[model samples]
Target chain A: MKIVLIGSGNIATHMGKAFMHTGHQIVQVYSRTLANAQALAKLLNSTGTDSLEAVVDHADLYLLAVSDAVIPEVAAQLPQELEGLVVHASGATHIDVLDKFRHAGVIYPIQTFSKSVDLELTETPFAVEAREPADTSTLITFMSAISNRVFEGSSEQRMAMHLAAVFANNFSNALFQVAYDLLAQHDLPFDLIRPIILQTAEKVQNNEPRAVQTGPASRNDQNTINKHLQFISSNPDWQSIYQKISDLIVKRKENNSEN
Target chain B: MKIVLIGSGNIATHMGKAFMHTGHQIVQVYSRTLANAQALAKLLNSTGTDSLEAVVDHADLYLLAVSDAVIPEVAAQLPQELEGLVVHASGATHIDVLDKFRHAGVIYPIQTFSKSVDLELTETPFAVEAREPADTSTLITFMSAISNRVFEGSSEQRMAMHLAAVFANNFSNALFQVAYDLLAQHDLPFDLIRPIILQTAEKVQNNEPRAVQTGPASRNDQNTINKHLQFISSNPDWQSIYQKISDLIVKRKENNSEN
Candidate 1:
């Protein structure tokens, strides 16, 4: 099926490339910048269009892979009599936001993406929703062409997933920053933590993370905990974070024991 | 080299097996329990002993792979006229604690170890230190046989690495627990987040995690943030964690912009 991707940002760049590799025609690429649109369009062998009106061309799906703030306004700009099924790839934005389109749906990929990222289809989770059963099926089938796992989730469920992604990906990445800062302050090379970080991630795939949790906080090793607390005492923000997360871990372990 | 392993725990079991696989003689396996010692000892065709005195036979190295608190007393129990090098594998414990022995060193593997985890050689980093230069060389050579990467890190550096490992491994795993809890509370399978978790981990291996940060907190998507905060408000601990981590991300972004 011919697909028109309506954004030339990170997600669109990677997703469009993945789709192209799978032998799907990316019909057109639209972005606020003609240069970006043309660049991605050229890569996909598709036409470039900065104007939303220009996206009325031939395509089976129009992926509104734009920012969350612009999803509704972008939908309003599309033709009232649409030529194809329209979908936006926003995770937090609701399904109803796409209701203005004659045929509308969502294809939210739940993964952290960037242009430099070389992604495989199996690594991406496509969370889709649609106004009608056939529309949903159509979107799922089209998505399954390039990806094996496609999930049917409600807008509310998708929102929950979006929040959870923050905890698992974005927030977890920030914690990496915290670790970097703490080590840097001690004049330690950030590279020393790299191997352990990779191993930590690998461990979860084989076992539950909680059962594998080991540290001053996990062991309730007060001596090391006190030392770390004193080490980070200068930074009140990190200190509070350390204290709260530690308390939470202990509380959760206690709760689990009760069960 | 003949190695006498003390404590038949996770690290001991794993390292013992690695040594046995490398065709090194594991002279003895000592633990609190005869059965546990026998089980691991049999794998390497070595004697299992509950009595530490009886097990301190003719070996080139005595590797004390035991709990952090037990190292000192264990070292004290050893006879003064020893004929082998002595070392403890506790990351947080000081190498000077083994000063009672004429020849003492450390062989601290920087990766998390479990008896069940089959570690790839190139992936593990070994941090070694010793009072004498020859001792360090012997330990480094022994470790290099089992691992590809070996670095000379002082006990201080290893302790710092151990602390950093807590943030990288334990804290990250705890965040995973939070992700699991948030999903489980909403009647979603913890499995749904597995792929996302794996991808998040993979991204950081070759790239800076700070560079790939995303989601509502990173974007400062106030609407979505407000909605998630509302949803998690009932769980006050999670609510605090969510708020603090969000604030940290936003603050860090601001800090990066200034620099």
Candidate 2:
């Protein structure tokens, strides 16, 4: 498949590499910053450009790997009459945002990407959506070349999945930052809790997270919760988060018991 | 080393197996319930008892692997003039809780444990605390036999570590539960987000979590955050948590920039 990658950020870099790995041709790379596009295009052996008019119109797919807020604007600037599939790689954005194209779809990779970390894309699940049944098949085939895990879902389902990712990946990492700051305040190394973080993630792979949930909040251990609240009393932000999450966990546990 | 494990719960079960793995003899396992004690003791080829009077007096170490609330009562019931070192496996409970003993310390493993999952103890960091310097060496040697990661800290330091673990492990898992519940509501498989969770944790293994943090919250993308809030508006608990955490993240990023 011939591809034109839009946006020269983490997702574009990773996706371009994955497409190249699967023997697909990346014909052009686009970024508002010409240098950024050039850097990625050089690696992919493709043309680099900052202007939307320069996007190759004849590619098999135009993968808009841009930020969510920029998707609509980027989609508006694409060649309106282009005879290629236009897909945005965003979990939060709806497929209709690219409705201007004859062939519009989504190929949202349900994984976090960082430029510094090399990820195994084969196992990363890609949620695919398309306006036409034929385009869906084409998108699935394109995704299958890079990943084994692909699912067909509507925009609503994709939004739900994105929301869940926010909690699972985004919010959870925020909690890790909280942990890191807490440890650093006491002159402790983040290394002390790294094993536990990995183990916690490992447990959720097979078991239902709710079933294996172990903590002061899950147990409704008020003494420990109070102690933690007291410990973080000076930091009202953490105190509220600590209290709110604990209350939520305890309530969930209670609901589980009643059911 | 001769050891007596005084608890038959999750920590005791896992710790007993680890102690036996390192060639330390578990002389006895004690629990309020004889069946629970027997269940763990039978696996380690040790005696199981419910009565505190039956605890072996000659063991080299009496390991109190009990709950934080029960530690004081459990310690009170032990043989007062015992010759061996006494250590509690708790993060929140201070080492001073066992000050009645001539040789007192702590052997708090910083990893979350479940009986269903087998963990490689060699990499699990054990936080050791001792009343005397000689006992610290003894505790270190014993811990070294089971794990390469051992550190000495005072009670205050250990409590701080425990608080961090709650954020890193427990609260992080709670966030996973939130994700799981959200997906289940939409009839989506939890498998979709599992890869991201693993990758998020894998990144933290070598990188500072604060440096590698990514998400709407971390990015301060209020557009996506507002969209997420609207998506979850029906659930008040999640809404409050979402708002509080997003605000906190934005505030934190601002703080980071100032520094």
Candidate 3:
């Protein structure tokens, strides 16, 4: 199918290159900024257009890989009587926003992308949703071309996944910052905590995180917890975080024991 | 140098094997539980003893690899007139607990160990601290035999590293539990979020965690943040975590910008 890329951002650049690498035809690239569109278009060896109105109507898929807020506005600007599946690449946006189009769906990839870092699609999951079964199949086919880990999920499930990712990815990354800050306070290099951080993440790949819960709280070692808290006595923010997470771990462990 | 493992626990088991593999003679394995002592002793071809009275006085090193709370009690029970550098394998415990011995030090390996897992010492940092410079040299030499990643640190620095590990290893691990739970609610398997989790950990390996911060909060994209908060409105605990971490990221970014 001939694909028209919409948006020349990180996701767009990544997907465009990936699609081109897989021998798919990207007919045109669209971005509000012509230079951005042309840059990506040149890479794909396709035409570039600043106007959404200039997006080729003959393309089989027009991926509105724009930011979440601009999805609806971008969809609204598309040429009428389109003969293709119009999909937005957003985890949070619902499919209803593309109601103006006859065939609409979503292709939400669940990984943070940096164009500089090569993305291995075999591990990156693409949670796809479509209004029509046929379109879902189309997405699965196209996405599977790049990645084997494509699944058809509902809009609610996709958005729920977006929320879940915040917990899994964003929040966990912040906890890393907390660790870095703690080490920095003592003039300790981040290298001291590097291996353990990798090991912790690797552990969860094959094991359930809850089952592998560890640390002073998990061990019910209040003595060490007190020592840590007192060590960071000047930082109330760190103390609160430590106390709350510790209490939660202990409380949860007790609950599990009772059951 | 001959070594006596003071406990047949996780840390002791792992370090014992690593040391033995590196051709260090494990003279004895001591555990309060006799069976536990014999189990580890069998692997190392060393003596296993339940009575601290039976702990050999001829060993070059007596490793107090026991629990933190019982360190002093266990130290008091060790045979007097011992002829080796006495060391405790604890991250949180101060070296003072082992001061009863003429030669006291710490060999705190900065990695969580499980007997079931093969510990790669090249990545596992052993932070050594001794009251005397000669003892610290002895420790660095011994530890460097198995792992070249040995460094001399003060008691305060070692303890701070312990607290930092809690944030890096433990708290971040709990966040993975949060992700698993979120996915479980929708009957989604944990596999979907596995790649992102690994990537997040890998990103911080070379870069500062604060610098590599990604997601809605990192972008300060209030639109998605509001959507996410509303989505998890039913779960107060999840909401609180989301809001607090998001606010923290936004505030930290502003501070960084000002600086």
Candidate 2: stretches off by over 4 Å: none
Better of 1 and 2 by lDDT: 2
- Evaluating just chain A, the predictions reach TM-scores of 0.94, 0.99, 0.92
Local accuracy of candidate 1 as per-residue lDDT tens digits, B1-259? 8999998988888888888888889999998899999998998899899987886657888889887768888888877567798888877888888887789999887778766667765657788899999989988888888988787888777776776676677777888888877777767766777777878777877777788788777777777788888877788888898888899888888888899
C-alpha RMSD in Å of predicted model 3 compared with the true structure: 1.9
For model 1, what is the alpha-carbon lDDT of residue B218? Answer: 74
lDDT of 2 by residue, A106-203 (tens): 99888999999999999999999999999999999879989999989888888889888888887788888888888889999999899999999999
Better model by lDDT: candidate 2 vs candidate 3? 2
Query: Which ranges of candidate 1 are over 4 A from the true structure?
Result: A57-59, A182-191, B53-57, B76-81
Clashing pairs in 1: none
Cα lDDT tens digits for candidate 1, A91-209: 78888887867788988887887677777767577888999999998888878877777979888788777777888888778877777776676677767667777777778776777
Candidate 3 docks at the CAPRI level of medium
TM-score (all chains, Cα) for each model: 0.91, 0.98, 0.95
Ten consecutive residues with minimal summed lDDT in candidate 2 chain B?
B210-219
**Candidate 3 TM-score to native:** 0.95
